[model samples]
Target: MIQNNAYIELMKETKQLENSVSKISLRLKTDQQLIQAFLDGNKESIGILVERYQRQLYFLCLRILQDHEDSLELVQKTFIQVMEKLYTLQNHNSFKTWLYRIALNLCHNFLREKQNYNKALSHLSLESSGSFNDPVIQEEQSLLLKEFLEELTEKQRNAILLRIYHNLSYQEIAEIMDCQEVTVRSHFHLGLKKLAGKLKKCGLTL
Candidate 1:
């Protein structure tokens, strides 16, 4: 039954959203401590850092990528990339931003590749059987919000994610995103416009 199926889907999505919120709220920044340990050339620190960021990070990457293996691979690749670039940790203060940038870049690349593959598979199935589909769209509002986010520019997408998901400040976002405060502001505006347009297109509005 459509009703039963929708109900089941709603329950699953609710559970996933609750878990994601709890995961992200956990002490997010073991960044500096990890950096200190990493700078000392202790490989264990790299593992520790990955453990600290793995949850919300997977959530973040998962949002942008395929629902199944992409998140797992991105999280692992993010850690590996950080380990290889460990010597570049100029300031422990910027570790969170730095780690995010690396992860973000990887997510974008994965999304690009995934999109190409998705196109090839579109004729095979209109339903998204890929694991990379949005996982947080439980309620009507949450579903709408996810749709709005999908319409955002990449920069806007990252800005909103950093602000809401990662809980980074504007200054911190600027540093991680490698942009000025004004550009951060601009991205927010552009992102908002795009989201609003999508809402209008979807016959939904904030």
Candidate 2:
């Protein structure tokens, strides 16, 4: 029974991957175009959207959850929500930030449920301490940055992640976080200061 279930799951994943590839072959130029296609019942349009944002969303979730499987699960859920709610997105230009809001909300729920923020941070600190020989320094920098970010309060961390990693404006972050632009700026600057001080103690510079 377990074998049959596993086989079924594998086939489902394979079919999804093939469908994704077929959609991606269209090479849609803009997110708005993709959304229109999706609204017009072109399911492949969503495949394109997922392909574009999945990596960044995955890393964003990883930085928050500090768990691979949890991040993957949240990314999947984010996309599912995006597909379901695509009709409600009024401003196509804001789709990226809107998608981010979905992810951040999901991450918030997951973190609240686990109530293990400190534990997650500690685990990331330990993980970051062990590696210096990674070939991709950019990736290493991102991991180290995430480890440092874990030291922050959730609001500060989210602000910094959206501002830095995602290149979101403070106004956009405020909208996503349901906070004021001033609050977003405060969280981002304070988070950066805290992270800088911590890194300085470790003889590292931001």
Top lDDT prediction, candidate number: 2
* TM-score for each model: 0.66, 0.70
- Per-residue lDDT of candidate 2, residues 1-206 (tens digit): 99999999999999999877776565645899889888988887788788889999998888778889999999999999998899999999889889999998998788888888666654542223324565465355546666677668879877866877678889999989888999999998898889768766765546
Task: Give candidate 1 misplaced runs (Cα > 4 Å).
Answer: 1-30, 117-150, 197-204
**How big is the positional error of residue 10 in model 2, measured in Å on the Cα after superposition?**
30
**TM-score leader:** 2
Estimate every model's Cα lDDT from 0 to 1. 0.68, 0.80
Model 1, span 14-131: residue lDDT tens = 9999877755543353677657756776555566567777897887776566465867889889988888886887887787788888888887777676665333222111122223
Number of clashing pairs, model 2?
0
Candidate 1, residue 186: how far the Cα is off, in Å: 1.7
Where does the lowest 10-residue lDDT sum fall in candidate 1? 120-129
